[model samples]
Target: MNLSKTELNDAELSRYSRQILLSEIDYAGQLTLAQSHAVIFGLGGLGSPASLYLAAAGIGKLTLVDFDTVDDSNLQRQIVHREANIGQAKVASAKSNLTQLNRLIEINCIEQKLSPEALEPLIAEADVVLDCSDNFATRFALNRACRAAQKTLISGAAIRWEGQLSTYDFRNPDSPCYQCLYPQDSGQELTCSQNGVLSPVVGMIGSMQAIEAIKALLGLPTLTGKLMLIDAYSMMIRTLNLKKDPECAHCSSALTERDPL
Candidate 1:
């Protein structure tokens, strides 16, 4: 993956003027975003907001992966899919929405479930990875791939009235990967299909995922080692510090190899 930044045109600068005016993002940061490629795992509620915001923020390339078709049940929180797209592949539908937002950016649509062989190469080309998949299997696979590729991953989950957002900076030797926080075999999966989610709760978490992704791509401060919990019902937000586990099978070896002693 080329790490070279892209220059903005008059139209792009004008479109992102609001973001550029901010002290943190200015021109250089925006250019960095234009150079970055982000891979998103799911095209459901979380991926909808994350991908949309990333596109609007001017990411140079985006790879969207999903095998499912848009269903009416997803309309409650998955804003990217519309009534007209009920039977279309999610990646294709998402690409349509994202391209309409930013025609200059590149959108790679992968309308199939990624196998281990397929995932590694895609992750190797990304500047950052977002785990928005509903199942634990995909999340664990993504965590391993990101750790091996030394990429930062922004993970988000929402079900019922609660939501969670966090970043696992696997590029940092001391940082904890997702498996350090939740073991692969630890718990049964709980999805929005089984429970229920408020419409905006996912938007809230997915929006935060976008914010962290932009910051991570620009080399700015991010929520890389902290977990944020949201209670949309009570409107309470809490953040907890995260620590790397010495016993974590996936990332512990890297940390051990880097130990100075």
Candidate 2:
């Protein structure tokens, strides 16, 4: 991150005026946002809102990764795409929308599935990452990358009228990663297509993910050690505390490695 770019210019101050008005994210917070970089691993339901808000809020740089193309089915919740974009790469579509939202920032689009070798450096450079991917493989890879990079991750999922959100700040030794909450062997993966998801349910969770990402960038309190569940059908929200798995292979090993004998 360039320290000099942390200072918001006149147009930036005016552009982000509403956010700057908040005492929590005044001039300094906005500047922090301007200097930060966020990488989003998925560009579907959850990634849609997350990328939109992050771009609109003036995150200095955004790296969008998605191997899929825009399908007509995505219009129901993927707000970042348009009907004309059907068949286009998701990252390209999202980049177009996000660039329109904020041209001052840089947007990098990767239109392929990233191997571990490709993902780690990107994670290492990001201040925060949003795991909006829909599969366990991708999620586990993202968790491992973030853990190794010591970056914060905001994870969100929505399916069948239920949405869940959690954050893992790898900078914190006690923070439980995605693997800790959901082990690698945790049965089959549930997807929006197989189970069905309400459009707004994803919008809600993605928006919250964006909020948590911004807060993490600005040094504010986020759901780092807690999981939030939203039962949209019942119109209820619940939060549960998360604890590190002392014997887990990922974060626990890092903790052990850092501690003295």
Alpha-carbon lDDT, every model: 0.88, 0.90
Tens digits of per-residue lDDT for model 2 on 1-261?
646684788889899999999999999888889888899989999999999999999999999999999999999999999999999999999998888889989999989888888887788788999999999999988888788778899999989999999999988878898988998898998988889999999999999999999999988999999999999999999999998887677766555443111
lDDT by residue (1-261, candidate 1, tens digit) is 345544788988999999999999999888888888999989999999999999998888999999999999999899988898999999999999889889988999998888877888898899999999998999988888888778999999999999998999877777887888898779798988889899899999898999999988888888878999999999999999988877777766555442111
Worst 10 residues of 2 by lDDT: 252-261
Distance from true location, Cα of 183 in model 2, Å: 0.7
Model 2 error, position 89 (Å)? 0.5
Highest TM-score: give the candidate number.
2
Model 1, residue pairs in steric clash: none
Best by lDDT: 2
Flag regions of model 2 displaced more than 4 Å. Answer: 253-261
**Residues forming the 10-long window of minimal summed lDDT in candidate 1:** 252-261
